[model samples]
Target: MTLPFFVYGTLRPGETNHDRFLRGRTSSEEPGRLTGSVLYDGPGYPYAVDEPGGVVHGELVTARPGDYRELLAVLDRLEEYAPGDARNLYERVERGVVRARDGLVMQAWVYVAAPPAAARLRAGGRRIEGGDWRIRS
Candidate 1:
């Protein structure tokens, strides 16, 4: 699916990977939130873990038409993701991300913590309260 992506960590604006990866590849970036998940701090990034009654703030990024496939491949590589891979740290899933502007729920690609990481984070990872990685303190 060539849906837009919901990014909450390093891939978000002003973050290190944003410019390196999405700067010119995107058509737009707008505030959004993924429900039923919480943000957890990773080594240098952040992971969104599935959880009840949770929401993670982020941006919904639409890729430029021509860069879709290339951007998708690059992001898969960057996220260390491979479809059906058992060792993946993150699993890209299609989820409803509510746009902050109009409260519109749009289906977008969300990279959530894979099984191993999700279990660990759910058990006792450092949660980013309020779900906004940008203002985490």
Candidate 2:
């Protein structure tokens, strides 16, 4: 089955990793938002964690069925997510994403900071109140 992924960091379009990873592989892409999440600066990258009143701006990408498995593997490695690993940096989960251009809502895979990782980032990482990693202030 084709899978949609919500990316809020380097993986987003025009970002450093976009060309290397998603550029021509995705079948469709659109601006989207995930509610109840906050974006944080993870030094060179950004991380997203659950926050009751937060909204994270990102993009929703649809991967063709032929590319789904390989695409996910690459993303997993980039995010340092290892299945069954207790110390994973991010935990991949399915969540609802709202397309920014329209009101359409769809379930997509999202990588969120794990509990311990989130706590650490909350204590040290700078929070991007606007929830957009592309914006710099």
Error of 1 at 91 (Å): 0.1
Instruction: For each candidate in the order shown, give its overall lDDT on alpha carbons.
Output: 0.95, 0.90
The RMSD (Cα, Å) of candidate 1 is 0.7
Clashing pairs in model 2? none
Candidate 1 residue spans exceeding 4 A from truth: none
What's the distance in Å from true for residue 59, model 1? 0.4
lDDT per residue for candidate 2 within 60-123, as digits (tens), equals 9998768889999999999999987999989998998999887789899999998898999888
RMSD per model, one decimal: 0.7, 1.2
lDDT of 1 at 57: 95
Model 2 residue 27 lDDT score: 91
- In the range 1-137, model 1's lDDT, one tens digit per residue, is 78999999999999999999999999999999999999999999999998889999999999999999999999999999999999999999999999999999999999999999999988888999999999898
lDDT of 1: 0.95
